[model samples]
Target: MQNPATTAFVSDFAELPATASHGPLRIEYRWVNEAAGNAPIAVFLHEGLGSVAMWRDWPQALCERLGMRGLVYSRPGYGLSTPREHAVKWPVDFMTAQARDILPALFGVLDIDMQARKRMWVIGHSDGGSIALLYAALHPDALAGAVVIAPHIFVEDLSVESIAQTKALYETTDLRSKLSRYHSDVDSAFYGWNDIWLNAAFREWRIVDELAAIKQALLAVQGHDDNYGTMAQIDTIGERVPHAQLVKLDACGHSPHRDAPDALNEAIAAFISRQRR
Candidate 1:
């Protein structure tokens, strides 16, 4: 496979060229125009540490399978996007901040038409999944469907425990250094997410009820062996949103997208295609 650094993508002004603001925070993103004509736009929202480059070829493969247009981007403080300038933890309403403020700014900057598009599909992983649910809940009519992998609807003891382990790895192991090479501002990305999940106010963070407001088709998937969260995370989505369908992949962990790429992509394409039909 050709290196993404050298891939033959239809060259255009690449990632993070657009600029927008959500309150005091600045957001950045990338836009890609696939030749697949008139297919629904498959927007990929990355996990907390993910960026446009971090998604690798998963977005391309999914878009190709569905014959769809696509958008892949980094959220604020992740990837090539702007970094958090302070040491503060994430806001309790961080998901809401992404949904209500950052998302609309991205669409506006990229000129994505939520009203006229035949379908708007979001495939979000981890923190991005929560943000996607927030968007779907607020604008149920704006999206056709969404696929959430390893999403956290309610904070759990296990989640905190796992994050604590990762924090230690950051301090002792070379995980932070390895990640630093990938992210331009690794501290901004890591602490922005890790610190928030570890904060006191965030312990009570739960949006299970808010998701019921989303009437659009939804798919929630998780792994049995996920170290970061439990099966209850995905299961709770179905309990709250009657329309939600759950899929569990055994032996998989926090990042189903990376751990089980083929299965993850297949499920996403099929779910979006099924909605179109």
Candidate 2:
């Protein structure tokens, strides 16, 4: 069968009633290599301010290289998905809510049978990385493995500092305008992620305890020069999840897929192959 990733796929939306209380959310997703025959499915999760469009062609490229099927989606309040209620502030456990509630609802709406497709894997970046880790922890039996890029297992001073700087740039520069092209509601997307991270109460936020429950294989990756977080994030994963592999790329920043796509793709392809065997 021909690889779906070779060409662009039209975006489809999934209405999730479980998140209706916050706002009506329709998750935007696209399939890559959908006809790759029973190969393991790799689900792509985007970063804090990321959307399906922001991911560009990286997911498709990676899936094509690995001969795998792919599902790339935008979470609520991102990309072409639902916009957040302007009055609502994301809670500290927002990532938990995403893993436990939003994602499952999305999968059900899309009819992805994790039980039948036991080799399903999650490839996540930044905030999505954390969400993927949380999902693997909560549903250990559902996933084959996970690849987390620049994931945050705990709040860090550097993260807070960089986030604060972003807030400043959003106000003074054209950052908001640039991001508007990707998100329908720029403020909702930006503040929803920014406010919580900058909140003093969030400093205590940590998911290290949750990592111990993840029985599936895991590969934690981060850039050596990542300004948003330090190596401790992946280090903590290795410390907790003894079987987890760590990769630190040199001269790369927060977004490894953008900065070092070739290296990131190779690492993920190899990790998934090893785990599947």
Candidate 3:
């Protein structure tokens, strides 16, 4: 892995105009393997603290392996897109809003054709994974399949504890400094995610019921040693979405792409191939 502090996070990025209930906004995005013009499109959603740059070269690698084009971006309050207000707090339904409002709007702004939409697949991690599930539930026919890694269907004590520890690390250690390289407004990116997860009201947050509404091919992946969440996360997904394929990786952690790239890629590629057949 490259030293984030010394390396450039995002080398080249494009901006698109998007409207939110709050107002008009700019979204920063990048295309991977654009030369695979007629291939399937893979849309990647990052973790709670992740950005386009944080994904590093993994999207490119996966797209190449799958013969798919890729779309990667930073959501508001993360990366270079837009920053959240210091005084504003994210609603408990924030992830839902992202899936229901933000994602579709981005697709519209990008003018992704219906043909492309039919072959679209979403690959998300952590918070992004939860959003992907919500989007699949809300728009069952919009995507062909989805891959959720270490998603949070419900708030867990383990999750809160990990996030709380991260907060302390950000305050006392160089964690903030390291993360700043990936975001335009570091505080906006950090606090927006941190404050909400730690909020007492967010303890009951869960999307278990929504799982039943998803009709697309789904693959849920989790790690045995994940500090932020446990096997129950993907296990519940399997319970709710009976057709969903579940992968439990040993000697892996919260971030599978980083922790076990080859295994993760192989599982995703096989699942997607099966869906096509």
Candidate 4:
């Protein structure tokens, strides 16, 4: 991992106009290889309950390896970004809202021109992976390709069971304390994801139709031992997208970027290089 002291990334904050009754939100973002002039840019989207800080040095490491610029940011309810108001329940289409609304707003604020950029990529993990898929679908011509790690195409029974266990651990264990280290408002991040998943209506959440609309190059990766999802997630993506590639890692779990960083980085770097060529 690159040391923070010598890393070339700059962390900053942007104020984005609120889409609803909440006031303007502050989004925490980091720019990697900002001086790499006109090179392809890869945007890293974190998992549910993830923040810019939670991604640690992975984005920088991957960008450095690929010789590309990177943009990493915390969603509204994560990291130092704006926290959701108290008692606000995320809607069933929360991921859609993010892909269709918040992300475009952020890209505009950051001055990233999707139309002009020839090699723009979206690298997303878990919930972020789902969001990336949604984004690519919504704006098919805007992306060169996408890398989705441990993404969910549909809600699964195992997902609900594991999420339930997580809720138990959050209440009865030190999980909340540990999570507090990564998020400024832990509850805002946690319940925003957790409640939505466990909600009765969320059981019907699925993105298969959205996946069909994505025409860009796609690489879908998941761990063989993932507790949050199964190979079926990526398999279904391939089934729907037709050209999507699937990678399943052994001895890995939901968080492949953490559990298998070297392998994941190599796979993604190679995939991006090929797509660019």
Writing each residue's lDDT as its tens digit, candidate 1 over 126-188 gives 989998889888877778888899998989999999888888999899988777754667888
What would the per-residue lDDT of candidate 2 be over residues 80-171, giving only the tens digit for each residue?
Answer: 78878788888899999899888878788888886744678889999999999999999888888899999999998999999999999999
Model 4: pairs clashing at backbone N, Cα or C within 3 Å: none
Q: For this target, which candidate reaches the highest lDDT against the unseen true structure?
A: 3
The C-alpha stretches of model 2 lying farther than 4 A from their native spots are 1-9, 19-24
For lDDT, candidate 1 versus 2, the one ahead is 2
Give me the overall lDDT of model 1: 0.77
lDDT of 1 at 270: 74
Query: Model 3 off-target regions past 4 Å?
Result: 1-20
Give lDDT tens digits, candidate 3, residues 5-70.
Answer: 522544443344545465566677888988898898999999999988889999999999999999
The TM-score of predicted model 4 comes to 0.93
Q: Is candidate 1 or candidate 4 better by lDDT?
A: 4
Among residues 3 or more apart in sequence or in different chains, the pairs in candidate 3 whose N, CA or C atoms overlap within 3 Å are none
165, model 1: CA deviation in Å? 0.8
CA RMSD per model (angstroms): 3.7, 4.1, 2.7, 3.5
Score candidate 3 by TM-score against the native: 0.95
Please, what is the TM-score per model?
Answer: 0.89, 0.94, 0.95, 0.93
| Alpha-carbon lDDT, every model | 0.77, 0.87, 0.90, 0.87
Better of 3 and 4 by lDDT: 3
